[model samples]
Target: MSLLEVRGVTKEFVTRGEGAMARKSVFTAVDKVSFEVALGETLSIVGESGSGKSTTARIAARLLDPIGGSVVFDGQDVTRARGKDLARFRNNVQVVFQDPFSSLNPRYTVERIVTAPLTYQGITPKGGRQAYAQELMERVGLNPDHCRRYPAQFSGGQAQRIGIARALAVNPKLVICDEAVSALDVSIQAQVLELLMRLQRESGFSYVFIAHDLAVVRQISQRVAVMNRGRIVELGTRDQVFGAPRDEYTKTLLAAVPRINPEWDAKRRQKEAT
Candidate 1:
């Protein structure tokens, strides 16, 4: 089942000329892009910088209103949902941004940050927020005792884990990860990817993972969407897109990524199978 569907969604920005000749011109950031994310599946949108992947993420998450087309979430057309309806929609979808530190408030304790969503929705956990926050911190591999620490006290990876914990507070149906791991070290990236996959297996939530790193996408995605010039040039299963790309742009992207070691790849596949 499709948890989220974006059909022919379009978003444009008006840019003005600098200085005396200030004239407005429309720049389309997302051009009639369309795709679907299945329940409990990870659909990765991969492309170079300025390829509209991030813009598409923002539109799907309802952070940016589309100029055209519709967004259907779990059978509801929430393209222009307002008031209580918008709040309801927000409770079911959350975003984890790229910069963990910037995303988290400097002054707020980890406990407060993790439970902010619940507070916004006026829902309290069975236990108090602090206890729930500690549980969430543990689930995301953080020290539960450190819940009182501020964001600045944690390392980059630990801060990202806190962000993950925050996203899970609402038990969202869909998580839009907009370059969520791009700022971390490669080792930290792998750990976070593993954590994300494990959480998906446990919670059965879908992810719209937007990233430029093909290697990371391969590790985490079941399906792939290739975007270029504000349009999706190709979309298919992981094997179909990576093994036998038909689009010229997709092929170029694959060609640019360094080949993974076959031995390592085989071991990884075996582990997945087990």
Candidate 2:
């Protein structure tokens, strides 16, 4: 069975008109979107901004409730799970936000920041929460000794590492990376991607990777879903979608990527052949 199933999920937002003269209107942000993420797989949702990819991620994480459709996790319906059930669901699923700087609390030390999930879930680690936090920091490539340092003390890449550590603190089955590497430098992005892939290999956790970057998506995703205007226009394996895109929007998105120089491409091809 799939680890996570989002069947015909939909979300809407209601906006009030400016002042008393304004009227209220409803806007559908996600329309009957459906996808599945298997255990230990990376399922990426790629789309331009405002395409509802983030909204879909939120719903999958159960951070937001969908007005329509159902979310099933490990064979349990979680669209309306409550109390202990909801809490357990949260522990099983975690999210790493796009902006690492804003996602972390500036006031808390790295130890506290990473251990917050454990604290909220009322879980005490085998040795100690701080010890577990340090272990996670090390696992994510951050210095375990720096656990006492605050968010302001780290660079963008380090801060993102902290966020990843936090998301993995509870040993979640699924991790929703909502543009988790977008804010870092290209080199840092590569490092973070490597770290995530390594962790996944070691931990066997699934990932719902949401991003607009097709190149990045191709790097980490086993399957890809392309969203446009609040719906998935194309869904397939990375090779199938990138090699032979069926949707026009998907083709346009692929074409939008900066083309490599002929000299560089030729060199790359020659190197591969050799």
Candidate 3:
């Protein structure tokens, strides 16, 4: 069985205009999207800004409720998990938001931020929370001595490392990276991606990576799901989706990626001809 499965998940938002004359309309953010992520794998959902890829990630993370369908993780239906069950489910799943600056609290020190999950779940680490948090910071490429520093003191990349460290503190089975590196500089983004891949190799954690960048998705994900208008237009292995996209939307998205080498098309053509 897959580690995580999202079956026919749907989400809608009701918007109502204020004042004397107002109209209510239901906006479908996600429509019957289904996919699965296996253990120690990365499943990336890529699309444009309003394509609902992030919404699907939110539902899978249990940060938002799905209006329809169910999310199953490790054979348990967690769509409506309650009380201790819900808390346990949350412990096994974690999220790293897009923006590090806003996702982390400016007032809290790095140690406190990384150990917050353990504190909330009432889990005391083997040695101590402070030591554990410092170890996590070092694992993510941050200075262990910087544990006493706040979010504002770190660079964007360093702040993101802190966020990643916090996500892994609970030793979650799955981590939802919602545009986790999109906000960083290109160089920094590559570093973060490498860090995530290395960490995954060591910890055996799966990722539901949500992003608008196709190139970034190609680098991190084993499987790719292309979303359009709140629906999945294509789903397949990275090679299958990138080399021979079956959906028109997927093709369009691939074509939009900027090429650093001007002869990239010629090289592709030559390689395909052979």
**lDDT: which candidate is best?**
1
For model 1, the stretches where C-alpha displacement exceeds 4 angstroms are none
Worst 10 contiguous positions by lDDT, candidate 2: 264-273
lDDT of 2 by residue, 1-274 (tens): 9999999999999999889899999989999999999999999999999999999999999989999999999999999999999999999999999999899999999999999999999999999977898899889988999999999999999999999999999999999999999988999999999999989989999999999988789778899999998999999998799889999999999999986466965674475457
CA lDDT of each prediction against the hidden true structure: 0.96, 0.94, 0.93
Each candidate structure's TM-score, on Cα atoms with residue i matched to residue i, is 0.99, 0.94, 0.94
Off by over 4 Å in 2: 260-274
lDDT of 3 by residue, 1-274 (tens): 9999999999999999897789898999999999999999999999999999999999998989998999999999999998998999999999999999999999999999999999989999998978898899889988899999999999999999999999999999999999999999999999999999999989999999999998899778889999999999999998899889999989888899976464864674475458
| Better structure of 1 and 3 per lDDT | 1
Ten contiguous residues with the weakest lDDT in model 1 = 15-24
C-alpha lDDT of candidate 1 relative to the true structure: 0.96
Q: Candidate 2: lDDT over CA atoms? A: 0.94
lDDT of 1 by residue, 79-146 (tens): 99999999999999999999999999999999999999999999989989989999999999999999
lDDT of 3 at 72: 99
Residue 67 of candidate 3: its Cα lDDT? Answer: 89
